[model samples]
Target: MSGPKYLGHLNINVRNVEISHEWYTDLLGLHTYDFIPGRAAFLSANVELSHEIALTQVAEGAPGLQPGQVGLGHFAWRVETLDDLKEFYQKLLDRDIKITPRDHGVSMGLYFQDPDGNGVEVYYERVRADWYTQENIFTNEKRPVGDFPGPWDELAAD
Candidate 1:
């Protein structure tokens, strides 16, 4: 019966991580608490989670994201539990919504496109203690979404 709680964070894809990091931090008055050198930075305005802004260097060879032509990579909302994720997944299917469920190493994510072809990600964060210890927190390892059998008998169209 649980559901998405609130806007967890935003993952912005930028061509230059260092410059964007500087831009965002200065513009927003955020402080960097953790980073993977030039690849990514988790910044904070001192939110409940480790960070509020997730900045990632654009993938090699990928064209720079521009306004209008740019989709906001993906925005995420957090569900309270794994059960909440499964229930929401089934509901999305019940309504015939197309969704791509993903396990983002740190969180369980359901990636899907909106009606206008914009990408969206609805996710359930793995309970911190369950996913990682304090010392080893963030990761960018890509993995396929978990294949959880739905409560509904019907399968969604890909």
Candidate 2:
């Protein structure tokens, strides 16, 4: 008989599951489908997948996250265009979320912190698989928007 296989949900332990629950739901636009008060909450990106994110409330007096810890680093959500990313960048700034924008050779990314200080990245890929190249590995070196060309200049004129 064939076996079922899949990468299941991601579970995160948060200081206050309720607050983190609300944050993820509001920020990422996920919906909470299940909840165990004072313990955990399961959130779904859509109706199909069981749960994309699960949050468990840490016991009272538990220690908070320490920097440089060996665990989950960050997660990214991809957008379609640089203009879309720019829109979100402004929205995040208006919300006073700490944000850092970067132009990866293959993508444009915005990094920021959630309420819990968890690193999150929202990005837009510049090139498709057919366009990627070995010579253009994205480096941490910064390049402001004025320094590089944007793809939508012609489209914007109309």
Among these predictions, the greatest TM-score belongs to 2
Per-model TM-score on C-alpha atoms:
0.44, 0.73
Candidate 2, 1-158: lDDT as tens digits? 97768556778887788888888887777888898888999987666877877888887667765789987787777777878777767667667787766655577777887767677788888666633454545443442342224543333333
Question: How many clashes does each candidate structure show, in the order listed?
Answer: 0, 0
lDDT of 1 by residue, 1-158 (tens): 99999666777666667876775565335689777866998987666578887878775555654447744676665677877777667667765668777654567777775333446566888767766344434433333336433433353433
- Which RMSD does model 2 reach against the true structure? 5.5
In model 2, what are the clashing residue pairs, if there are any? none
